[model samples]
Target chain A: MPYVTVKMLEGRTEEQKRDLCEKVTKAVSETTGAPEENVVVFIEEMSKNHYAVAGKRFSDQ
Target chain B: MPYVTVKMLEGRTEEQKRDLCEKVTKAVSETTGAPEENVVVFIEEMSKNHYAVAGKRFSDQ
Candidate 1:
């Protein structure tokens, strides 16, 4: 089973998230040959302060 | 780049999580040859209701 996770900022619409889950599940299943149901996708949302790049947080930018 | 994630219950202490991040980073770096700093470790906490096995959720058990 291939478990996919998409981590990004916490500002997506519910419909966008629903579409993402469906499309991501399909893509993962197609590429990894895992069944659609067996492929679990978790969406993790992080706050800007908790996320950083190059030692500077997104909230600071 | 190598990214390590430890997905489990949400009851570990801060000390335990700190140790986990350090050890996991080392392990991933050694095995994947990625720098320790580049080896990002994200700790994901899942609720019992959100996780299930064999159609039975942990909260129900």
Candidate 2:
């Protein structure tokens, strides 16, 4: 089985996430020769405060 | 700043995940020319049953 995970900042529309999942699953299946039935995709959304960059939190960015 | 998130199956050792986070952060920093201090990485583990592909759950795969 081929499992894929995507992590991004919170706030994208559900439609965007759905599209991303579908596209990523398709791409991984094609690239890895994994069965479409064996491809699993998961998404995680990080809050602005929980994420940071350049010594500042995402909320500050 | 760049924030990176990784989602994967729940069984990887903490050390493995740490390595992956480091490698991915490095890769993104190099490719995007983002500073190392600007990179933030988060990992989320999905239970096998919480992820699926085609018509089957990852646990079934």
Candidate 3:
């Protein structure tokens, strides 16, 4: 089973997330050859203060 | 690029998360030989209401 997760900033509409889940599931299934039903997609939203890159928090930028 | 994600219920302290990241990174490196610095560990905390198993939400249980 190929479990895919998309982590990004919060505030996306429900419809956007639904589309993302569908598109990402298809992509993963196509590339990995996992069945569409077995490929689980998780969406994780993070606040700016909780996300950091290169030792710099996004909220600080 | 071996990226490991530890998804669990929220409310873990910062210290706990830091330790989890370190340990998980070490495990991934030992198993996959991805360098410690190159192995990224992401801690995703989800609320009970947001998590579901077998089509049943944790909050519902």
Q: State residue A56's C-alpha deviation in candidate 1, in Å.
A: 15
Number of clashes in every candidate structure?
0, 0, 0
| Model 1 bad stretches (over 4 Å) | A1-43, A47-61
Q: What is candidate 2's lDDT per residue for A1-61, written digit by digit as tens?
A: 6878787788999899989988898898889888888899889777655454543445544
Write one digit per residue (lDDT tens) for candidate 3, span A1-61.
Answer: 7988788889999999999999999999899888999989889887754543332335555
Reference-based TM-score of each model: 0.54, 0.53, 0.51
**Model 1: per-residue lDDT, tens digit, B1-61?**
4655567888876656666666777777787787776766666778899999999999999
* Top-DockQ structure, candidate number: 2
Candidate 1 positional error at A17, Å: 13
Q: Which lDDT tens digits does candidate 2 get at residues B1-61?
A: 5767567778876556556666777788889998878787766668999998898998887
Better of 1 and 3 by DockQ: 3
Q: Please compute DockQ, using alpha carbons, for every candidate against the native two-chain complex.
A: 0.09, 0.17, 0.11
